[model samples]
Target chain A: TTPLTFREAPEYLTDEKKTPFDAVAKYNNFYEFGTGKGDPAKYAHEMSVDPWSVEVDGECARPGRYALEDLLKPHDYEERIYRLRCVEAWSMVIPWVGVPLATVLSRLEPNSRAKYVYFETLHDPKQMRGQRSLFSTIDWPYREGLRMDEAMNELSFLAIGLYGETLPNQNGAPIRLVVPWKYGFKSIKSIVRIRFLEEQPKTTWELLAPSEYGFYANVNPEVDHPRWSQKRERRLPSGVLRPNWMETRMFNGYKEQVAHLYKGMDLAKFY
Target chain B: MAKVIVFCVALMPLIWLVTDVVLGRIGPDPGQEITERLGIAAFQLLLVTLLITPLKKMTGWPGWLRHRRMLGLFAFFYAVLHVLAFLQLILGWGDLWATFTRRPYIALGAVAFLLMIPLALTSTKAMMKRMGRRWKPVHRLIYLSAIFAWLHFLWQARSDVTEMVVYGLLLLALLFIRAYWFGVSSLVPLRKSRA
Candidate 1:
């Protein structure tokens, strides 16, 4: 693929120091490739991203398979340097190049019945070793979803590239969602299918552990993960001697932009 | 020579970790790398310390007991380092009080390490002699420490319990064998075996 052309979007950018491209590219949690932080960087190259097609169906007026190029054609890509926080309590400020997910979904004409937007990652056990692992509790295709309003949120993004280059397979090649306020897992990787649903579709992690991984995995330090504290996160490239710990913010510090979306709802219950 | 070799082998993980740290090869998150390595080393040492008794009983070998004290102390050493890495390198001292109060797993790990202190301090021959009647009972705290350590790891396990499960099974097996032997040794009269 030719180098992606994207203009820097000032609104989407954060003043936080961007994590080095090497660390962003090398450290990943794309479990389809493998579970280890470095496994995706090592094995993701084996999975083909070219000749990719996204199947958009369910409660959408235009339900069909769109080639990767066609999906990205109408939208001009923008570089969004957003803080990417993982539920595992590690974070990085990543400059992602993509179109707003709302722009893409609006073009698809989601019908009035569409209450939620469901997504599915590419499934091929031959390519994704984790899919074939007997130890994994996740069902294949790695499904995820967002409530319709959440899907339409301005901050929701569809990232195609990072660091002014085409995204490495380890960091979700071809196309992936970038829900900055939510945990990284909510930003599904290697998308192959998207469905506008009438009901909140069950997500992969939520299915594995409903109590821990709820559908709306917005970054909230107030609510702790069942196993560990969410109060703070270690910024990537942090060393033993020179630690880089920071207090986690509500909505990952995007509360001003996204707080209205969850106004009166009890976050702890939803979390 | 055997003790020296055992000590060197036991120290290898820390050496490798320090080398990795100095060389900047400890991956993207050095704090996590150091803490995990030290924690796992402590756990592995704890398992080894438990294994010595079973091996000696099975083989009727007295030589295995010679290295047990050193192995136990090394376990305590790694455990202390693991705690330090978390408090100093990961959480920082400012957040230590809050983290300890809120996080059960971290508190449990601290408890496990604290349980090792008396065992390590009393490991000396002179101290063991002075506490002769109570030495065995006090040293039995290692069992409680093992339980807490395992609990600490288990409570922190997210979805992938593979590592925790493996460690837990090994611990259970070691404890079970000792429990079984404890029963048999009471029935059978003690006899000095060929050294």
Candidate 2:
């Protein structure tokens, strides 16, 4: 399918009324560029993101390397205005355009043993200045994973674009994962690989600091990160003296769609 | 001579902050940006202060000792700005209980600021002389304050921890250098006795 044929469904546009793109772009937590919210917008421009390829491997029947163009060409894009909550106490409403991850994974045809999906980013230190720093705790070629069920969830999107434009390099171009219900980091950026595995796959943040960053990394306000409280978040681009900056909702307000995924399990423990 | 230059250098950020505010370039929330900048500056100055003794021991830079006080006071100055910014911008001096109780990051930041008050107040020649034998022990709280300040920064950064981690590593390196110096010196005395 050509890019012109890609259109957002009416349901997605209705959601956009409640959550705007300005809030989404202004209130972001993209650390790859720098720690500041504005850093992504400024420094992400330095990234050489074209000529990207995503390698699909592990237990999949048709595991092979696919160029970004080929991967994004087949799907009809839809806008999803998701409330993105960071593990830190902050949030934003993002209008992301992409195909459902379930739709993409179904085409890949996972083998019976496939229990989890792993993702990795490009490892070029020259292009990614963050990778050059030895002081950074995050390992180079940042990685993240999700259980097979989580990967197949309708809420999860293999996002290709945002705000009616192609994904900015700072916002994880050419493609990124978007698990709207989970904390922002669970939505890994600049993905170059997808692996289906039998065992629970190791994620980069969890591997770096397991005690601090749990494996699930789901958006459960009750499960406070060891260092800080997750109960509340500061909305970005806050006016000089505006009180009542938007309040954070449970599961980043995707509870209606995804709360059932973790039913019967204790959220505090999984968190 | 170097001490004076170091003191002036440390005040550059504060000067830039005032200029930014005056130029209308401080964005809509000048107060929050100022508070964050000042808090970060205080932590950076504290990290520099913590490095003085280690640098003196390692490189025999006796001049480093003279600059330590100035750097420490700069840390206190920026900390004052940080607290004032929070009060004026975030708290607004109304609803005292709500201001103090609602946000835990504010509390963590306040504790760090409170701890520094004693250190800053006692940083005078008169106070140091009056305290005499107790001065060294009291000044040791600077180390604790630095750790608290680091924790405050870490806690404030919810999702994007890159800045906090950068500052955290700098503090760690400074602390590590001190521990290494102490370990080496203690080992030297034992070696000399054996010899």
Candidate 3:
């Protein structure tokens, strides 16, 4: 693979202390590999990503399959340090190097009918034991979507590497979406397909439990999950005796950059 | 010697957990990991406490019943640790009252823990003798506590409930064995007269 040429974008960097690279690599929720926090790190190494491709189709003029390199070659990369807050009420600050999702979408030339963008993770039961397990209710090839404007938002990134290196297998190697404003699950991992759609796509979590997980899934402290409060999160690497607990911010502290996109829509209802 | 062995064995999980935390072997989220480990240990001990009477009945030996109080107390000990870990490590004691009121799972777990308090307090021989018949009725709350604990786990499950289902079935089997034995013992006089 050709080495990625990228520059750190000061405008995209967050002042918050970044989570240690080891912690970021070890703790993951990639259900494809497994549901356990450490499962991805333990099992992801077996799944291959050296030769990867993404199928981009639906409501786009330039609908076709593109090699991973070709899709990434045209655009320059930028390093953005963003805070990723999971719906489970845990968070981590990560330094990610990637190109903007808009740059890729615009280049694809989405048609007038396109109102939303849908994304899907690679579904291979042989490689991903979690997909083969009867225990998980998640229908394989995990799906996620964003409104067209939300997709075009500057904060919607498609990350390829993190912490100045290509992504670790467990941390969504090859490519993944990173929407800072939304919950970590909204940032789908190990993506294999992208589609522009007219109607909002039914996301994986929403499909499994609609009441608990909604399509928008914007990080909002006011809207509590059915079983737990979203008001606070345990920042990762928390000491057992001295835990690092912080009040969860609306839009995961990306409110200024992404709030205008929601405008008058009810986040509580959407969430 | 037997009681000492039982006591040390019952204390092993807590000892292991503390050692892991100290050694940095508890994983990335030690607070959450510790909280879950303690909660599961408490639940497992509760199941073991429930098993003692049935084992004594099956084997026609009184030895198993001797360890019941100690095991039950250990379950309560773990439950206390679990709740403290959640309160300090996870919640940081922030808006706790609101959390209890809003999250039914937390409320369910709290109810389970609360039910064990009376059992632990009344486990003393003097208190048991004073309470006499009342003691049995009060001790029956353990069944209710087990149910609440199971529900606490069930409600929090996301998508997959296989683990919760297995636990529920195990709890049901234990309860069924006790109820069946109760029915048989209570009918002993009628059966003897008929014979």
Candidate 4:
């Protein structure tokens, strides 16, 4: 494989304080590996990303299985530093290396029938120890979706690497989606398939609880998850004495860029 | 000597946590890590404290009776740290009153800790003497606190409740053993475990 040519990150899109790469890899909610914060780092090494192929199907005009390298071959890779707020009220500003989802969507040539893009993660319990655990309520082969406009947004990213290095197994290598405006869970990890759908797709968290986790799952300070408040987020690399919270912003502070996509729609209802 | 060993064992989680922070190790979200560690330590200690009475009842372990108060107090100590970890690390020591009012789980957790305060104070020989016959009734608040602590844990378990169910089952077994002792077999007017 060719070494990735790193692009200079745009100033406006990145965070100045880079969370240590070790922190990014160690703390995760990837249930395929495990549910604990450290579980993915411990067990995700079993994940096989090299031989990966993504199935792009459904309403797209060009639908077929594309090897990971061939699918991403034509696109330019850019690093984005964006805030990732978990529904659990924790957040991180990650420097992700990948191109916009729009670039991939355009290449696939989605027909007028495509209203949503549904993503699926790897489901093999033999490799993913967490998938084998009957303890998890979430149905396996994690799924997520984005509206057509949201998928095409400038802020929507599909991350392949981090901190100028190929992604670690725990951080969703060799490729994953990174939607900055939505909660981290919406950016599905270790994605294996992408399907264009006419109706809103059933996502993992929403299936677990429709009231608590909606399909949109956008980061909104005002819209409290029925379980807890999303008004404040504890930034990673928290200082020992003073672990202060940063006020969570609507659409994770990408409001100007992506808020128009939800025009005239009740965000709280869609939340 | 065994009490001192138990004290050190009780203190280990906090020691591990402090050292991890000093070594810059407690992972990416230290706040969440510390918060959960302390909360779990407190919850586990509460479970162990509750277990003492049953062990004494079942195995007739004299040592279980001797160390019950210390174990209960240590449980109280961890509860304090658990409460402070939330207020300090997560809340940044801001508006605790708001925390009690706004977040019901925090309030549940707070109530559990509040229940511990009087129990700790009364566990002392002087206070036990001061309260006399009323002391036993007051310390029974442990049962209520344990329920609150478990609920506090279960409420935050948004996605999975496997651990919560385990903890809940443990508490239920403990309570069932007590109820069985008083109501069924041991009607022979046994002496109180705590002298």
Candidate 5:
């Protein structure tokens, strides 16, 4: 695999004012750096992202540590303007430059028993001080899982860059997952390992607060978060004093594409 | 001069928030930033208001009591700002029913604000004179209001409650001191006489 390049996005997707690169780069939930909004920008400099490798194993035909560059060589890339909605009720319209995760997963060649795709983030406490800090509430080496079909969705992207620049450290440097329909946390960051599983992997958030955050965190305005309303989201790159809040769409308005996957499942229960 | 200084000090955060908004210094989500800052300012001012009584008792300074009304009003001021921002910016003053049903933390914030209304309206010397001995009992609502304020903050946190725990401890200590000073200790004048 070799590094892929991104060009112009489709015309229909370019409507929202692109989130200023600085804001996207600066404001993030990469808790690996620290808990505060600006902490990542302040502490991410210490995170070395170059010369990284992702380990692929479990239920796969070819399992080994693959260099970040070689992993991307075979796939075609595109820049898609996506509305990145955070579980915290804030959202940003990002122009993400990357290849589809489906493209990569297919290349890995999952065996007959590969029912689920499990992902894990880097666990180094030295680079990520939050891992070592006693105040952290989340379990480190954060893990997430998606059914094989969900991972193969057309919308499931493996992001490498944003605003045409290589993925910034705070925005999950080198590589990260981008699942537009699901809440942001479902898309894990700074992934170090990926495995094929027959059963669902216990995600970090689900273990921490099961009732609050479900495994399938599909964005639904009707099913409000216990603490805050998801009915409306502050679409970012908004005015400083007054943000224009728009009614949140079910599946963040990606219903036509991804809704078929969860046809009969109780959304409220899954949420 | 101290009155003006205290007033300015309390209002400085609001001023900075407005100035930052104009300059585009706040990040992508300005609504969230403004809302959180207003809420925090309200909480901080309310906490400071509680500090006055203890500080006065420890230092034997009656002057602190004069600024107590202004300080409490500042807390209420921020509370009002916080709610207004939530309504105008976050909720768009739309679907009030939906907001009430879906999000309970907003209710805690609203209840805290409503509790402060009477205290603010009665802050004037005229109302204090009008209420006479009843005024003291009415103003005791601040303790409950402060508790609501803290709960509102604490409930919104998903996890990592280190800061909220600190505030909770501070509020508990203040309430404990008040209960001893005014509740049981006031009636026990015998102890003061013996000392």
Candidate 6:
């Protein structure tokens, strides 16, 4: 098998300069390793991520587990630098390398009954200490879901790697979902399952706090969480003194591709 | 000797926290770091405060009580710095009214800070005497402030809850010891001995 060469494709460029992946990888919101920004980068090395497989089932015509190698072998990897915004008011631009999610889901062959696509992360408590924590409000086997249309969006990527390397465990090593336009949690990490469902599937954060985290966690500056403001987000590698933070943009600046998806509905209510 | 060493060691994190903030290493949101440092300082002070009774009871260390006021005041000192950092960095005076009115988390933090004011003001012996019996009740609010402080930390956290859990356990242990002491004193009678 030939070694796959992934390349970076800039989505949003400001004055002809692409956003750096260092900015994206360094400033992350992965809590499984720890709470701090740097904690994930430090502690995620402990994760054992090889020999991975993803199980596909539910409303799909063919239901079976596929090896990570076999699943990734077909696609030509392209690095698309995307603006990632967290619900907690922070943003980063990541250069992600993967095929479009639609391209991957098309191979699964979803039936007419498939209305939603649910994702699940690996549930090994031995490797993931966060799973063992009793105080965590989130249930084990962190799960996320998307509407079938949302899953098939061109903007969504079935990301296998990031920052010009194979995925780091902290950033969901081996493979993960990257929905750039949505809030950070919507992009589930270390995915092991992709099940097509007839109904709207429950998500991890939404299950933890429904009012705070919605199923459609699109980047809407107008919709604020009960605890904090969404109007601004600290762009990471946060410098000292004034102007460290940036004004948050709607749909994480992917309004061209995604804003139409939420046209008729009220975002504030859904948020 | 061990107690003094432990007390000094606990102060190390506080020292580091301050030095890091001054050196501009705590990132853009120094307020969050300040809050975390103060919370840890407060917890350590509370632990030290609880240790006073145990040391005095078990080892006949009467001098332990002398350190209580200092430890309690240090806790308040860090807490005040935490509140000021939040005001200066996060809530900025221009947005203070909006934050106080709109954001629930800010209100929770503000209430916690407000509760600490009376405790800090009456910490001196002169005010303690002037306030008389009210001092005890006023100081009791520290327990409530600890709860608020924990909640403030818990709510501020994005996803990882491990740090909050550790703090919660420490607070629980200290509260448990106090409850056990009270329960034993109230329920059990002392035996009379003839010389």
Runs in model 5 lying further than 4 Å from the true structure: A1-4, A7-13, A240-242, B180-195
lDDT of 6: 0.73
Against the true two-chain complex, what DockQ does each candidate achieve?
0.46, 0.19, 0.57, 0.57, 0.50, 0.30
Residue lDDT tens for model 1, A1-271: 3487878899887778899999999999988877778889999988999899999999999999999998886347999999999998999999999999998999899999999999999999998877776656677888999999988998999999999888999999989999999999999999999999998899999998898889899999999887667999988878668778889999999999899999899999998
List ranges where model 3 is wrong by over 4 Å. Answer: A1-4, B184-195
Query: Evaluated on chain B only, what is the TM-score of candidate 2?
Result: 0.86
Q: What tens-digit string does per-residue lDDT give for candidate 4 at B1-195? A: 998888888889889999998998887677778889988888888889888888887797777877878888888888887777777888777656666787888889889899899889879888979978767667777888899999998988756677888999999888778777765322112223333
lDDT of 3 by residue, B76-128 (tens): 99999999999888888877888899888899999999999999999999998
CA displacement after TM-score superposition, residue A58 of candidate 2 (Å): 1.6
Ranking by DockQ: 3, 4, 5, 1, 6, 2
Model 4 / residue A219 / CA error / Å:
1.9
lDDT of 6 by residue, A1-271 (tens): 1134775555532332334555455545666765576667777766788788999999988789998886775446887777778887766666677888898898889999999999999887777766666666667688999989989988989887776677767788778999988999999998999999999988988888887899999888888777777888766545433434677888888888987778898888877
User: How would the candidate models be sorted by TM-score, starting from the highest?
Assistant: 3, 4, 1, 5, 6, 2
Candidate closest to the true structure, highest lDDT: 3
Native interface contact recovery, all models: 0.48, 0.16, 0.64, 0.64, 0.64, 0.25
**Backbone clash count for every predicted candidate, in the order shown:** 0, 2, 0, 0, 3, 1
Between candidates 1 and 6, name the one with more favorable TM-score: 1
Candidate 5, residues A1-271: lDDT per residue as tens digits? 1234666547426587877888888898877777777788889877889889999999989899999987885336678889988888888899888888988988899999999999999999889877777756887788998988889999898988887778888888789999999999998988889999998889989998898899899999988777667887877776654666778999989999899999999999988
> In model 2, which regions exceed 4 Å deviation?
A1-5, A14-39, A241-244, B1-11, B18-35, B46-72, B83-112, B123-195
Judge candidate 4 against the unseen true structure and give its global Cα lDDT, from 0 to 1: 0.83
TM-score of 6: 0.86
State the local distance difference test value for candidate 5: 0.84
Error of 6 at A18 (Å): 7.1
**Candidate 1's residue-wise lDDT over B42-159, tens digit each?**
9899999989988998899989999999999999999999988887877677656767877888899989999999899999999989987667667877877998999998886555
Model 5: CAPRI class = medium
Candidate 3: which docking quality band? medium
DockQ score, prediction 2: 0.19
